[model samples]
Each structure stands twice: as structure tokens, then as C-alpha cells.
Target chain A: MNLGLDRNTIYPATHMWRRFSYFFFAIFFCFAIAANLLAQDWIKSGTGLGVERIRIAVPEFKAANQDPRNSELLRTFNDTLWNDLTNAGIFEMVSKSFYPLGQIGAPSDVKFDTWGQTPVNAAMLVFGNLGASGNNVVVQGWLEDVKNPNSPPVLAKQYTDNATTQQARVIAHKFADEIIFRLGGGINGIAETQIYYVSTRSGHKEIWAMDYDGANQHPVTTLGTISLSPHVSPDGSRLAFSSFNGSAWEIRMFSFDLNRMVSFPRYGRTNLSPSWAPDGTRLAFSSSRSGTPEIYAVDQSGGNLHRLTNSGTTNVSPTWNRKTGSEIAWVSRHGDLPKIFTMSADGTNVQQLTDQGYAVSPSWSPNGQFLVFSWMRHYGPGAPGSQDIYLMDVTNKQWVQLTHDGGRNDFPCWSPDNRHIVFQSNRSGSLQIWSMLADGSNQKQLTTSGTNSEPDWSWK
Target chain B: MKQSQSRWIALVFALGAILFLGACHKKAAPAPPPPPPPPPTPTATLTANPETIDKGQSTTLTWQTSNATDISIEGVGAVQPNGTQQVTPTESTTYTLTAKGAGGTQTATARVTVNAPPPPPPPPPPSLTEEQLFAQNVKDVYFDYDKSDVRADQQSLVQADAAFLQQHPNMSVTIEGHCDERGSTEYNLALGDNRASAVKNALVAAGVPADRVKTVSFGKEKPFCTESNEACWQQNRRGHFVLNK
Candidate 1:
């Protein structure tokens, strides 16, 4: 029997290397399946469907050398990783006081009984070590099931970058994402994502960007004019916003590829609130080119203009359901006050989604399952309620308030994972960008110095 | 008797000479030359630099005076005795400079030619385009809170605006809808649009062409007043007119 084998010409080293790689791949595949199964069961429990939130203990990373940069970089890395996991909404972190009083850095140093037993009582254990050698920083991290210590670690990773504080935070985010993927029901984490928002820190409302956790806040536009409603493109290469170009408010685009403003055709009227389709080939905005502020759509290159709403009343703020890219949600004032409405992308099958009060800034979830918008349920001169962000199920029309009495919260955008939301609120005396889990827990203020509003989270 | 006659002649001759001398003294004394004619009547001459210019351009008006205490130009208020000023007049204008002194006032004039564009030009030196005149004369009609209809008190203003548009038959205008900063950005935009539309409709009903009246909404983004008060808000919520040239 010929099995396409050349046994006589096979080299011993090559044969051994091929066999070793095959075994390695087989083990890797098996471990991946095992880890996925474990995470699936844990997610069910974490969601209150089975048991409870996973108890994870993260000990401070050990320092490998006495370099002066090691302590600072290690602190940044540890803090970032801890905050990422804490904000994940699924973990019950064990406090540092409960940690065993000894160094827990390498896999060989892990004591299963110490972490798995009572008093420490962690279901999962995260440990790592960081060091800086000359200009480079190196880190190694692992996630192990303390409950099943005999099994292999669910995650093991190493990262190397320039010995800088920012890179340290980045490496921490990457490691946290890996752990989240292995234990958060196979969904990718959003720790590394960026958010774009309008900030008044520069004396003008210009587009500003920051890391998901609100670090590295920087301005993206220096237009020195009043710019609002910043919506980043789905591909994360362009930012579309409404800018007052001295005479009129027009839709403007800033290209990240060129690091400057790009040319877009002015629609000859008040054009505002540009939203991108999921495919990044089209945009929907509100324009008064047709004598009324109606919802309009245009191509990415500013061609193929089409009108979507003919309601002679006030129709504006068109947002696309990014998952399907077939439906859009907007605000209309056919009656006394504005209400939210949704319609097909081709301008047919219009449906009213909101029945009462003032609803505006409807941002659809990435899954196409819910719309998160700012609403004043009892709106009037002396109404009892304030404007707050609310999330609603598209299929059932049921809703839940995500912000309560926290001043006025508006312009909520969903993260790519659909587990987090970034919004603007005036709870801290000024409008600032904030982030929270989908259930409204872990609300963290992302911007504090400037009046920031209209956050848009990046797609990736 | 000859001596007596010669003496008599000499006496006559002396008397005539004395009379002649008196006349010469009265004429040749010069009467102080009439006190130099009172500071030369305070003369002043005004001249324009680059006397002819296109409309919207500026020119220097220079003046010179011999002796004056108070100097002023018409429509320009007070000025120095002899100085130059850069003036930008929307239309062709003749500037008159007056100099007042103890001696009676004196006046001089300079013409600044604001030339109109050529080819079928309107036949007036102090002419402004229909659009420019409309911007200066048209009135903005106001609205109530969350209401788009032209208010009863604002009807006269709307009529006035319509009357201006009617007089300028060749002009086109854009009415901007604005709102106070008391509502959401999107809703205010719609509200502003309604306000603009209501004013446009009122103008059209008053006999202005609908095609010549365009509308746009600035929402609450551009406020006529920035203070947080009722008076400011009332000023903000109106149909502002812009010339479409």
C-alpha cells in the first residue's frame, strides 16, 4: 500500500519536528475546547441563570529586576488590568488583603490549595510578572482555574513593548482581553477600544478621543469652532460630525488616515448629525436642503443623496441599526413634542417606536437587539422627570432605565462587544463622558476636566 | 502894492499847500489794512484720495484749512482742522466739511464715487443692490415657546418683512429658523424649521414668491442672545433673515 510516503528519504530531525508540532496542535485544540466549555458554564452562572459571579483573585504582579521604570510600569499595568476586569460586570474580585502573604508570580510558584481553599476562596487565579530591561518592557501573564488546579492553565501569554507607561497599559489591556475571551463566554473584550466625543476643553467644542478606560485623552480636531455630534465611522478611519463653518452648520469629515480634515460636499443648508452605516459605504444625516430638516442619506464620497423622510414637521437625528444596516432610527415632531421612530433603509415601512415625551439620540446596539436613547419621560416646563438614558428591546418594546437621577444623561453609544455603553452626563456638575456596563453597573466617569458629550465608541 | 500882492499870493499859496498836506495825511495813513480781513475767512478745502472706487471699497478724505477752531464732517461727526480719514460708505456719498471760526463759517465738499458694477447697472450713484437693501430693512418675525406660528404681536413685523421683499422684486432671501437653548438639539432643530417655515408661509401669503424665499433651521446652535433669561430667549427664537446674493 502506497500512502504517498517517502520513508526511505525522511530525515530523523525533520520527522521528529513534524510529529512534535502535530502533538502541540492537538493539545492546543483540546485545551481550547475545554476552556470554552468551562467559560460557557461560568457565563450562565454569572448571569444569575445558574450560580453566581465568578470569584477571581488578581495579585500584584511581581517585579523581576530593580530597574527604576519597573515599579511605575508595573503599577500602571496592574491597575489597568484590575480595572478592566472589575468593569467587565461578571467578576467578583477578591481583595488584596485576602491574598496569601508570599510571592505568586510564576506558574511554579502557584499554590492551588492557598487560592482554592477558604479565606482566599478564588475560583480563578490571575498572576503575572513584569520587568524592564534597558528600553524594553516584558510581561508574562496567566489565568488558571484554581478550582481545578490539576488542569492546565486556561490562558498563558507574554508581551513585550517599549518601556513606557502607555505601552504598559496597552499590554495590560491585551492580557485582560485574552483572559476575558477565555472566561467571558467567548466574547471579545473592549478594553483596547477608543471613544470619540466632543469636548470643550480646547475652548471650542472639538472632537476628542481617549482610550476605553478614559486614559490618553487627546484632541482629534482643532477646527476652533463649535462642532457637535461626532460619529466615528464603522471602520474607525473617519470621524463625521456637524460643524459650524462660520455661516452654516454642515456635515464634516476628519480622516484618520490622513490625520487632517477631508473634503465633503456641503448640502447647502443646515446639515447635522452624520451617522455611518455598518459597511462604512453610506451615511445618514439630517439636512434642511429641502426646506425642512428631514432625514437624508448620502454616499461616503458625498454623492448619491436621497431623502428618507417627507414629514413636513421636524425630522432629524438618523441613526443606523449597525447590525442589519437595513433600518434607521430617528426623532420626529409630527405632534407637539419629538418622538423616536424607526424605518427601513429605503424609506418605507415607517414605524413609530416611541409614543410619548421627548426622545432623541437613538443609538442602536451592535447586535440589533436594543436601542439606547436619551428621553425625558415627563417633559414640560415643570415636569417631575429629567432626561435620562434608557435601553429598549426592539422585539418586545419593553424598556429599562439605565441612568437614574444622575443629572441629564444623553448620547449613549454601545461598545463593539455590546456589553458596555459610553454616554455624556452632567452628574458631576458639567457634561462629561462616562462609561458603564449594559446593566448600568460599574459607571465610571471617563472625562472630568472638560465639558465632554456625544461619545462614540470605536467599532474594533 | 507889489509886495502886498506877493504876500497875499504867498498866503494863498501857503493855505493851498496846507490844505493839500492835510488831504495827503488823511489818505496815506493806511487805516491798519482792515485788520488782515479777519483770519482770511477761515478757508477749508476737502479732497478725497482715490476718489472713485467700487462699491464696498474705502477711501481717504483729506482736508486743509487756514485757521479754524471747530472742524467737522457731515455724517462723520467731529474731526481735526486738517486731517485725513478712511471712510467706507455703502453708497456714493458727498462729504461736506465745515470750519467755524471767529470770522464766519466756511464749508468744503468732496465726492466719493462708489461705482456700481457695469452692464445693465441701476442708474443711481448712491445705489445699493436689492439684496443688500433687503438685509438692512427686513424685519424678523418672532414666535412663542415651542410654537411655530407667527405670533399675533409679530404679524406687523412679518408684514413689514413682506413689504420689503415686495419692493425689491429681483431679490432673494433665506430665512433662518432659530430656537432658544431650552430643548434637545434635534428637537430644537425641528422647532426652528417650523418657525422658519411659518414665516416663509406668511410672507408668501403676503404676496412674496415662494421660490424667492428659502428656509433653513439653525436649531439652538446659533443664538442671538447667550444669557439664560426670558428676554434673551425671546430674542433667540425668531426667523432671522439673510440676503442670498
Candidate 2:
């Protein structure tokens, strides 16, 4: 090493050139490392700014056929698809009003440069065409990554169904679901689900079903007496609810396939708040059959009965942990007020989830990480709090109040995808069903004509 | 394109609304200051003819007042203040008269007493029919919202109902449990069931036959008071007794 350094020390010109080359190499290496690091997105968890929804674009599909009915299908499909994408909560949908005057709504017609401009600025695009054929409707859809020119589309799908308004809407929902599945990190979309609730529009309470977007409101039971707390099965074949049969309350199972009351067992005392397990094999409900209110489980056929809780102090509203299927979250009155509690399905390891106040209507999230419940922090004759909805992180017992003191909000149920909550509130003067995102944003009224309550979001 | 069209239409409609309102405002006279509130007037009156009477006989009561939007008696409900009404007292008792209006409220009392007892051989039966008497004997047992257990304060009512059931061995009573319009409807139904069962259990504990009592839960469907206030809700949540025919 000394001998090599002696030659460089004697040659000033060579030494200067070596120094310059070393400096240049060092600067280039730094830039290459920094550029690679800068290309990645920074992930954070400590602030509300962590949420970054993917931006997407959807344009009204072109009418593929000349039939007049084809116009109706196209319009319906477009509106429904827009609503589904907007409500997904994982997408930032671009406004159609921002689209360029030249509408290119097909795979062959797309000009990527126009969409990549300032007004559109879409990362993903959903384009499709719909037509009416005899008694069926046909749709062709393509979802493209506008930035990727090598292989343009990320998803391509086709759906065909009977040529009815309901079927047309369903096709749009399915296509949106497919796009969500492909780009939303495998989270299922809630577009094709239904919401069942109680409506008093007919002068008496009855079970009513509606689309997830509050479309297609129709009564499922015309029992003429009071019916409440409707829970649809996992497969969407039957609905279980409690109806006043001019006597006491009974669990009545109504078949959607038959559109009539199917035979279920008539238990003694009263049965209420029917909740379905993640699997459709059994149901968990509250019953006074044991001379006091307790949580009970029964098969879907109303056989093989077993009691889950014997708290003897109004144990009620038993909702299962849909993910584990081993634990149940319910309301139990162990102290001065009713509180939310979680217990093993066999009533073995009962643990109180709430420490104080009047809490009821505990609904486990689909992900099994949190629970949504109605709580009155200082509940009493002259308490200082109003009933509202709250979300609790089960692991840490950290709770976030969803609704303020607007009105008495209760009976909150989670949507299938765990992105939304449907509840009842008296905020609009009378009891009405309302919906909101899981974070308590985007509140919307679902029922206007009649008093609605006890909303149960459907399983997929 | 459709969204833009709607937005343009909305903008036009908003402008039209503003201009129409401006025109109306221009043509209209300045609104006069609100008229002074009407002077409040006090109301007070009371009279009873033949206050003393035999047991089981009724007395005529009349009163007049200057200003009253509503009037009521202690037992009898809403009545005209200047009108005469009849009241039947089973024994010596006092009747409270109240008159209410925007001004305020005034109350008065009158006494009615039985002059003498029957001639020792036979007692005077009440003027009320047996069915009506039984209806009065049946009292509603109250409960807390979503509670099926009998409260400490409401135990006396359940005991009295049990005694009434025992007095008429051949009678069957239906215990209807009701709830306030709060909480989930299905949960309330179960709570109502528990409430009725609790009342029935109380009666059975008090030596009343279990077979003579039947239970039903109306949940929140049948409410005694439709008002959405705390007092009304308290009245709505109860274990009511009805005699089955």
C-alpha cells in the first residue's frame, strides 16, 4: 500500500483526477439509493390522515341495443354502479360532470391521454355496455388501470340476467363487487345485500326489506299485528322475527322464497331479537321461557334447544362473533344498569365488556375486532347523557362515540362488509331508520314515510 | 353531463326564488310589532249540593270560573267548569276540583259524608256493578324499562292483585306486560314477557293458583300514554291486569 501511495504522491495530476472520480461516484450512489426509497409510499397509523382511498372513474355505459327498454337498463345500471362505488368507502370516485365532452365508454374507444389529464386524473376506469335481449339483459364491463399501457385492463367481466329493473340493478352491483374485489385488497363489497327493518307505514308494525341503498322498500309480513326485529338468514332465504300473535310474542320465520310464513316452533313465554350465527345452522335469541329473561340458542328448524346464559337479570340481544363463531356479544344487566358483555357460546368464559351506563344492542363487526352498541353514559331519571351509538375496540377497550346528543339512537347493526352501520334514531322528530359509514360519517335517512326501527343488515 | 345540467337547473331555481322573495318583500308593508299579550284572568269556584248523603248515593257538583282552558275533578276527568256533574262516593270522602288555564291553576275541595249505616241486618252494596268493582280492584303493576323483575315499590300492587284473584276463585286473570317505546322492539317483547311472568310468580307466591293466571306481553305496542315524555313512558311500562271473560 505504501509503495502504491508513493507513486500517486509524486504525480499531482493523477492524484487530482482520482479525487474527482471518487467524489462523482459517491454522489451518484447516494442519488440512486434516495430515488429508490422515494418511489415507495410511507405508511403511518397515528393520525386520521392515514386513510388514502383509491381514485376511480365510472362513466354511463353505452346502450348496446336499440330496444327502448335498453335505455332503462343502461340508466339503472349506471346509477346503481355509481352508488355502489361511492359507498364502498375504499374508493374516491371521479365525478361524471368532470368527464370530457367526448364520451368514450368502451374498451376500444378509450383514449388514455384524455383520462390522465387534470380534470379526469383517474388511476382506474370502469367502462361497460348494456343491452336488452328478449327477456334478458346483457352487460359487458372492463376495469382498466389507466397508467398501465402494456396490459390495459385489470378486470374484464360480463353479466346477463332477466330484463327487469331489479335484475338490471343486480347486474350492476355484481360488476361493482368484482371490481372492488380485484382492487380493494380482497375486501368484499356490500352492493348486492339487503336491509330488513320494522316499518309502521301500514298503521301496524311489520317486517320490511329494502336495498342497501334504500331502494325497493316493501313489506315482508302483513301479519296485521306488531312485528319487530327482523333478521335474514345467511343465505338470504328466510327471515326470522318476533311477531305479536294477538297474544304473546313468538318467533315467526317467514320464507322469502315462498313469500309467506313458514312453520317454526311456538315457544312458551316470549322470544325476541333473533340473531343468526355466521353459519346458518343455529340462531341465538333472548327468551323468558325459563321464567326470567335469558339468552338461548336453537337450531334453524327450532329444535335442539340449549340455553346460553342464565344471568336472570335480563340477558338479551345475543349477537355472535361472526368470524370466530365461538363467542357471543350480548347485553346483560349485572349491576345497576344493563351492560354489554361477551361470553363463550356455551356461557363458559363470561366477561363484561362495558363498565358503566346503560348499554344495549351490541353488534360484532364482521372482522371481529370491534363492537357497535347503543349507550347512555349517565342513564337515569334525570341523567345528563342522551342515548347514542358507540364503537368499541375490543382488545383495548377504547371506545369512540359515533353519534352526539341529536336524539335517542339505538339498534345499530353492521353491514356485511363491516364498512357501514344501520341504526334507528328519533332525530327527525319520529323514529326513522338511518345509515352511516362505520366511522360515523355520511349519515343518511333510509325511511321517511313511517316510523322505522330495529334495522338488521343482511348477510351476503 | 347530466350532473352539470341538474346543477344549472338548481342555480336557475335558486335565483328565481331569491328574486320572487325580493319582489314580495318590496310590495309588502312593514310587519307591525307583535300585539301585546292578552291580560291573564284568575279563575276560582266550587259548590256541592247536599254534601251529606247516605253511602252509595251520588251528589251533584257545580262550579264556574272566568278563564280556564281545562278543568278536572280528582276522580272524574275533563269537564266544563260552569257545568254540573254527579259523583258517587262509596264512603265519606273529599273531592278535589282543579281548573287550569294559561294564567295558572286553582284547586278547591268539597266533603261528602254518609249520614247513617244500614239498619244492621243487611249492608248496602256499592252502586257499582260487580264487574266494575272488580275492574277497580285490579291495579296495574309498574316496572323499569326492559326489566322483568318486580320492583320493591310495585310489590304491594302485585300482592293486592293476588288477593283479588284469591277472592274470586273461579276467576282467571290475564297479566299483560307492556313496555315503553325505547330499546329494540324484539328485546322489549322478551322484557314484557319477563314482566308478566314476574307478576304471575308474585301471585303464585302469595298462594294464588298458578293455573288461574295467564301472561302476555304487548311489548311497546299498547301504551297507556302516547306522549313521548319520561312520565308518559313510565306509565307505559307496566304489568296491567285484565280479567279474562
For this target, which candidate reaches the highest DockQ against the unseen true structure? 1
User: Each candidate: what lDDT?
Assistant: 0.80, 0.77
Cand. 2 Cα-lDDT: 0.77
Pick the TM-score winner: 1
Lowest lDDT 10-mer window, candidate 2 chain A? A41-50
lDDT of 2 by residue, A1-460 (tens): 1111223222235533343233222211111222222112112111111123556789888888787898778888999999888887666788888887765557888887787667887877889888888988889999888776457478888888999888989999999899876665455678988999999999988899999889999988898988888999988999999887766678899998998899999887777888888888899998887677788989999999899887776777889997778889998776646789999888899888889788989899876767899988777767764788987767556666777638889999999877789999999998899998776767889889888988999988
lDDT of each residue in B83-195, candidate 2, tens digit only: 78888777665556667665556666676665556778744554335457678897889987656679999888888888887988877888998999766555566677778
For model 1 the TM-score comes to 0.73
List, residue by residue over A1-460, the lDDT tens digit for candidate 1: 2211234423244533343233222222212223321223223212211134568899999998888888899899999999998876657789999999987779899988999877988988999899999889999999988877777788889999999999999999999988777777666788889999989898988999999999999999999988888888988999999988866778999999999999999987678889999999999998877776789999999999999999877787888997899999998885677888999998999988878788888999887767999988887777854788887766556666677745878888999877788988888888898898775656889899978888999998
Error of 2 at A169 (Å): 1.6
